[model samples]
Target chain A: MPRRSFELMETHIPSLRRYALVLLRHDEPLADDLVQDCLERAMSRWHLWRRPGNLRGWLFTILHNIYVNDVARAVARPDVVEIQDYFPAMAVPPNQADRIRLREVTAAIQELPDTQRQTLLLVTMEGFSYDETADITGVPIGTVMSRLSRAREKVRAASWGETRENGRRIT
Target chain B: MSDLPEIPTEDEIQALVDGRLDPARRAEVEAWLSENPDEAARVAELRDISGAVEQVYGHLLERPIPARFQNAAAPSMARSPVWRVAAMIVLVAMGAAGGWFANDAVGPGGDPNVNLARGAVKAHQMYAREVRHAVEVPASEEAHLVAWLSKRLDAPLRAPNLDVQGYRLVGGRLLPASDSGPAAQFMYEAESGERLTLYVEQNLTGGETAFRFTEYDDVSAFWWKDGPLAYVLIGRGGRDSLLTLARATYQELNP
Candidate 1:
């Protein structure tokens, strides 16, 4: 492919990262690396281009494979996130506390079970259609629905000061 | 007092919020949701998770798209001499009506080798030529410098003695790796703006050493490796001077 094709790849990166960040939550930098690896593979395998119906879907499939492989590799060699490896230049901005609270919510979301979080973020953050979520998660459409429903319930229960019992909202 | 089915059917209604339902199913779901206010309310809350999720992951969004990413899609990674040289081939490859790029590396956050080199070069340029802010820790205390940088990088390191090259050891600092991993830039300056820097980081791609001199516009960089660790020496000087700086850097770093 020409340079323009590479440019197209560049354009789609944010969406790809939005998806990858949620999949491999917390270790966002690692997610960036994973996304890079996937793109490089896609570049080299440009010949493997059959022009699938959904190009974005195919790319995400590659990303998914890469993340799964990385998670496997990480088992033997743990990747610890060291926060103080670098010093910050910017002073904490006004309402930095809001960001901290946001980070807490994010952390809480990260703490959600992998399945639930993935389902919620895929259907929510990325705004993937349920079919796309099912395809990305490799689950049946019905399963995707249940997982997302449960994910929403769980996150709301924990974060919104509410709970569900007997399939009904308490408040 | 109710005859309840096995499943509450909220799952189906939630799927409707997700836009999973086909026409008939969707219509049915909306009707069901209309009657079930409580289920509808919970779905609404869950639906808002989208914005919350964006807030969580969006810090990175607000963070300036680092120059690395910008540089990649910018003119260089987008259009390089290599690309210019291979234009004929790449065009023919494209002319055949071709390509669905994974858009992974090239994608929104996928900054390429050019950007990576630019990052390495920018760091080297920024630190090496610096005087007052040159080193976070001046080279007077080599022990503390080595200890601190080594501890950060989690590897033994020695700021190579470039005194022979007239580039005295100014000092070194632990800098954020544009992406991840720890990055250290050793700064040195002669009587001129002729500063040289050795930028090192853990293998990002885990690929073999990309031992090539890449010039993104005017800035020149020579990158190589000794195994897993990747090294990029960036400076504006001529090739010979750069080689001298690189050799001294490699020898000191190795020995």
Candidate 2:
């Protein structure tokens, strides 16, 4: 329990919060709660963390597990909030048109399947390597790449006014 | 060179957009893109998607981490509800001792300056003892350090010159304030190896307070609110000497 370890872990909290917010589709309170849970779990299991291991990836693995568990629990309940209801409060950006585009992009990301969305965010937004993303998501490297590709394609299509419905791509 | 394909695979194209390709492969992809305008446009679209994703979510990194999450690593306080309640009672008692009359003074989401000071002290204790990695950005890059921290905290910040007091700038790191914002911690060290840290955060309550002192174990902190920000100077020195440093820091920052 050296102080250095705590300090190092603290450095990663902002990134953790960022990942959590995206994973939970910008539900700030729920995201913070998940991060708190992840950190507490990490602290209790600090001994399992090898000294030279990638701590960021380790924390993400823990967070992804907790999120999956929470999703499972929520699916059992009847009053689950619709994922569409959690769009971020639009912070005022300098440009009006850019804000609209940004909102569309965010919505498109939200429309992705859970696995695809997780892979896309971890690689594109959080800047994790493909190997690290696969490790964190517990998928093979090829699966990670395919998920990311599909996610990006869907987002691109959404922006261009194309949508996929009932196994058919439509414009 | 022989391994280079005539047309990049989808993964390789995605990697090209992500800037993950090695130089030789990247050059090969760019050469192909130059010949294939349609494929190049698709690559551009992929790049735009990533950029938009970052644009949509990047500000979360700047937001202050909540108070509860800040202590997630503390062993005694991690999961126990009883300890959390006890911790709240202790905070309220400390607020009363400090003569703050408002019920929320130092309570959860109450007076943020008190929480700021506590955060400052915690950061000092955690980082000041380090021989290396003491600060995220070192004093040699003082301009970049100031600009980066100021941007994160959303306030213009000045690292006070403590040269006259024999402590030089050791650099600074951005910390999560107990409230919903970022705090900046600038570390300084004397020739004798004694270290001090100056913590700054955006003032939530605009009401300015005169300098107040607090001690936690061996470390002492002098904190106050000035114009747009709150300040805390933490050190292990005696009161008068640390006060001298605090006053010097205050003047440097305000002026």
Candidate 3:
């Protein structure tokens, strides 16, 4: 492959790592492992990636597929640990209150179903359009919208400390 | 009455929060939000969530990519016969240079010390010229810097005092060192504004080696291994000057 192609892929890695971090719910090592697998797969399949295409979306699609396959394999095993138990220990100190709130938001994101969390992060954090997100996640646009809405509502409720049972209904 | 503004849908509200809406639709959402306090609050909350996610996880973007992942593009390049021959020619040329070139052909699968030296040179070329962000954690917090890098590398690392050599500790950052695990880089600067970096990592293939020196363009490096740790001292100075600093580092680190 051309060196420029590799550089282009390199530019997307930060976003890829960020997306993977949230997807795997802050497990840094596992997230990096997923990214490595994605990069390797993408490199091996470089000919399959059409130029004049959304490379970011293509890469995310590869990462999401790898993650899904890994999850599928893990499902066959009974010893998987709850993802919530893996909240990362803070390496650097931030303002206590802000840290707590961010932790709450992260926890809320982790609690979301896989599809919803993926949709929400791809849209909100990674700034993918609904169409692009649908393409990446292999779902319809309407499904992306619904998953995003539900994911945002749950996260909003959790952050605001509003119980779904008693919170004023969101129309 | 026929010209009434259309109320935005749930998806439209989200689009507004994500700043994905077109101008006409965004204006309509803004107009609606102006009159609806509760909806506006929820939109604000959603916006906050995105910001918080960026705040919480954005630091990963600033990290140096691991050497293995950075080399992910190499496999394809390696498959090409032309590139393979060209790489072999370059490797042969480097190998003829002596001392440091002894293990130069080992590439990624070679001696751990050689990898340490190459990784250090790559990092120095990458960060030593930066006007800003030269190191992840500056030396003002030397104690904390050492502690954090030590924890990451899982070795008790120190930013060896180079002040006697007129080099002051600037700071250090954690780096991924191929498949060997994490590496730490500590940078130093002299009054002439010349900068040097010390790259340290755990020597998983544990044995000691004497100093090996190599130069790439203007930059030169001297790398050695001690029990449980490998070190590479990189600079733009003459080989002799760098060796002097390296020896000082060895003494301080060993003592």
Candidate 4:
């Protein structure tokens, strides 16, 4: 055990947690377990990590693969979620307007398709480049780009509601 | 759509927002964005969704680490692959300590520019997703934003206008610098929800210089120095697009 690798793994816990929370839709305990599983795998494979370009990206790739292979169905079931379910655990704003705004945005995100949601979250929220996202998701870079675009469009359309301007629905 | 030299494909626009386009093509896509406010705003909105996702879940990073993860220490003994295991045991015995493992993490590195770029990117990642609480002082208080950040930094700072580029000030916050001085970050957003951030710090010896681009992870930065203040414009766009914003910012701030 290099011990240093463990320290480095410690630094990445926050990132892994954030990614898992979003991916698992605010299920904190389940997200915790997923990150725990990820770290455990990384520990066992510490010697195999080939000190490459980005350890963060490598760790994310492993987590994503596990997510796809094992945890995808458990976490990504869209029909199971209702927008109202998003805020009970969160600190609700006292102001009604702010609460409404938060609800709309959260609902829009909750409505996104699974793959698009994952790709968009990884790219926009986590600051992963398209290449890094593709590597993590095991998809082509083109697929990552398209999924992000479609995902964003859907969220925008959902949050803003569609308005007709020049014969086209504008978000 | 009818008269432009070429319209960037939807994929290109997606790439533009993802900060993955190459320099040459980035300019073309940026030109398209500048010409099309509707498209630009839509792109900005798309970017905002990520911010929204981040805002909703970002607090997870601050939550206590679960015991299972915290307890997983690296294995002291390796039973597989005798040579590699022997090598690992030797290295552990030697106490080399990330000897060949550490590279390009956020820290005091060789290049000040790269370090600054990293800082800017990191701050951008941290707060750009915040909707109501993204900035310490909101854009509605622009005058106060400049005054407060300037006072804190002990250097004159301006929130560069990015209107022509279709990005408006989202607001700003004070950030602790890796060095002794303080740093400030100004976040801006296009109508579509794309965000670009300008990070300013007051400790550099270089005079006026050309824009240079660097990336840490997915965030891209375009930075330059004007006397003491170093300004870094970070966003999802590639070099050509970021260069355009950087030049516009430079002119506004310098003027």
Candidate 5:
């Protein structure tokens, strides 16, 4: 590992954590564990990690992969999360209604199909662009957009306490 | 005559949000958003969702690096593959510990400390390249500088003299090194505008303690361990000059 590579990893650590936290859901220990694992992979692979003009995106790809890899996820979940709680945005004005709505979003994410969940988290949760989403999830670009669209529709419908019929959400 | 307005389909709205739409479709979505305030509001809501997710989970990204990762996987320093392709993954420069020379990617020998020196040398090279603020303590204050560094490393030493080789101390600094402890760097410059740096850290505990060299592009690095400290000299100077500097460093520090 070149000296700069570790620097790169350090700079990217926070962004990696943001993505992990969403998946791990304020589960500090597990989220931290996952981020650490991702960094180790990132430092080792930093050479092949052509900036591709997006180091942040590349890191999210590593993190998301680790999250979904069955063995690793199994290892990550058991000791880290305690029922996956809410992080209710600090500035949310502390309204019961707002908290309820936030629950809808997280719950919808949890209910999303794996493809939709990962894609939504990568795009919406991790701030990766659609193109980078494909790179991270190893899915087609169309798939990333479609999954995001489906995920959003599900969240909105779920938010309204409604149902989604195929792609259409009944409000 | 016309009571209905053209609305970009939901797909087009998604394409717009995804930034995947062509300029023509994008213009159409803008026109739609302008006409339908309600839909535009929803789009803003969704973007907020994206931002919120980043907010909630992004904290992990911002938190202190966990300690467990510092002591994570310890692969063998030697890679003699059960699979042949694992060779490509070894770092391009392994320093004295199978660095750039060994292409073994997947095995049980990837040492974190090996990555440590690589991290320091790379930091030295970068900060040294900056002319305006090359070092926190310019070599002009060798005494106070030595006192400061000695306190950090918990050791007694001055900037080892390199004037014998036409290189004078540019300055020194104490930096948070790899996953290990702190590191001390003594940078030098020759009259001809060439620069070299000796990055040193002591008592490397569980890392590979060997003498190795790696060349990345025009830069050459010579790394070795002497007694209780590890040193790497980074420079673009020829092998002979760089090696002489490394030896001078060893003699000055050890003798």
Candidate 6:
């Protein structure tokens, strides 16, 4: 058995969890459960893990695949939730203004079409390079670039409280 | 080098904001930004959004690993509910005599304590990374977890209070302690999402104990035996940080 490789899988859990969280939009419990599923699959197929390349990217690709096949495939894409619901009702104020802004940013992120959100978080939050992000998301590098660019522009507009009508269309 | 690259494209600009731009092209982008105030501000906004996203969720990295994700070594070990409850009760009643038998069943290395420490660290590494199932039972059922784990390890188990240190009990889970017998892993999480695990197992034979510290991978674990229990405190922090928590655990349990 690939014993050392098994142990190495443990190291990637934190990053996988974070990526799962971002993809799931702050839904902590679901994100974590998804991570568990992803790790379980990776461990079972330890021999299949391509060494000398980006293991983190490989793990992420597995997670995104599971999500697409099992979860996202069933659940219809979620529409932008009420902006107020974006911020937890219990979140108190010293961070209130920032929280509200963050909520808007997240909602804008949530508002993104599924493909864009997936591409955007993989690049911006997880720090996956264009090539790696493309591999994980199973898209061309140019697509990853365009989706990320569009995602960023949307988030920028959201942060500034501008509506989509004011946003420029990307060619 | 003197020639300007075809007015760095939009993708190039986005690459700059994402920190993915090649250094060679980066200088061109910077020169481009310096010349264009509006575009620089846009890049600045993108950078802020990235920072805020990290700020919002970075703590997830530090949160305790849930029980469901702990045993990555054997995903099949996760049993159905009826089996889980029955196993919890039966494992404790059996008193890890099986593990004891297996201990001699395998060859011994020098210092049984070191072997125990290794088992402790292994358990720590596995369960400390979980989020949803960090513990076999959640803290809401604190009474049951204590009673169950106490019975299994055959030690009087009390969840240590590390409130002064800003760590609160998240929950505890049952772990196989290799040859030392079945062990209990108690998890605690700080407000900032940092986690610490205390691994407890029955000390089959009593001996004098002192704090012994070691590290595995990136995790630092401190273990010592006292009376009937051998304890290992593990976390991904410096030795000093783990020592402080280990000392706190010792005092709480010993007191």
Off-target runs (Cα >4 Å) in candidate 3 are A2-4, A75-95, A163-171, B1-4, B76-255
Give the docking tier of candidate 2.
Answer: acceptable
lDDT of 5 by residue, B126-228 (tens): 8878888788898889889889887887767558887756789989888776555778888888998788888877755634443455666567777765556
Residue-wise C-alpha lDDT for candidate 6, range A45-149, written one tens digit per residue = 666776787788889998898787665654445555554543343324326556656766777888888899888888877888899988998989999989988
TM-score of 5: 0.48
Error of 5 at B7 (Å): 4.4
lDDT of 4 by residue, B26-138 (tens): 88777878989988877776655555555565655677775545445634221222121111111111112222113555358555755776677778988887777888988
- Model 4's CAPRI class is incorrect
- How displaced is residue B225 in candidate 1, in Å? 10
- Model 2 lDDT, residue B77, Cα: 26
Please state the CAPRI-style docking class of candidate 5.
incorrect
Interface RMSD of 1: 9.7
lDDT for each residue of candidate 3 in B144-208, tens digit (9 for 90 to 100) = 99999889888888888877668899999999884468999999999999999998888888786
TM-scores for chain A over all candidates? 0.70, 0.80, 0.78, 0.81, 0.78, 0.78
Cα lDDT for residue A89, candidate 2 = 34
How far off is residue A170 in model 4, in Å? 16
DockQ score, prediction 5: 0.15
Interface RMSD of each candidate, angstroms, one decimal: 9.7, 6.9, 9.4, 8.5, 7.5, 8.4
CA lDDT, candidate 4, residue B31: 81
Off by over 4 Å in 4: A74-99, A163-171, B1-5, B19-27, B74-255
In model 5, state the lDDT of residue A107: 66
Best by DockQ: 2
**Worst lDDT window (10 residues) for model 5 chain B?**
B80-89
Pitting candidate 4 against candidate 6, the one with the higher lDDT is 6
Question: How would you encode candidate 2's per-residue C-alpha lDDT over B111-206 as one tens digit per residue?
Answer: 566677777888999999999899999999999999999999888999988786678999999998868779899999999999999999888888
DockQ of each: 0.13, 0.23, 0.19, 0.18, 0.15, 0.14
Looking at candidate 1, what is the lDDT of residue A107?
A: 53
Superposition TM-score, candidate 2 onto the true structure: 0.53
Candidate 4 versus the native: TM-score? 0.50
Give the TM-score of each candidate: 0.48, 0.53, 0.52, 0.50, 0.48, 0.52
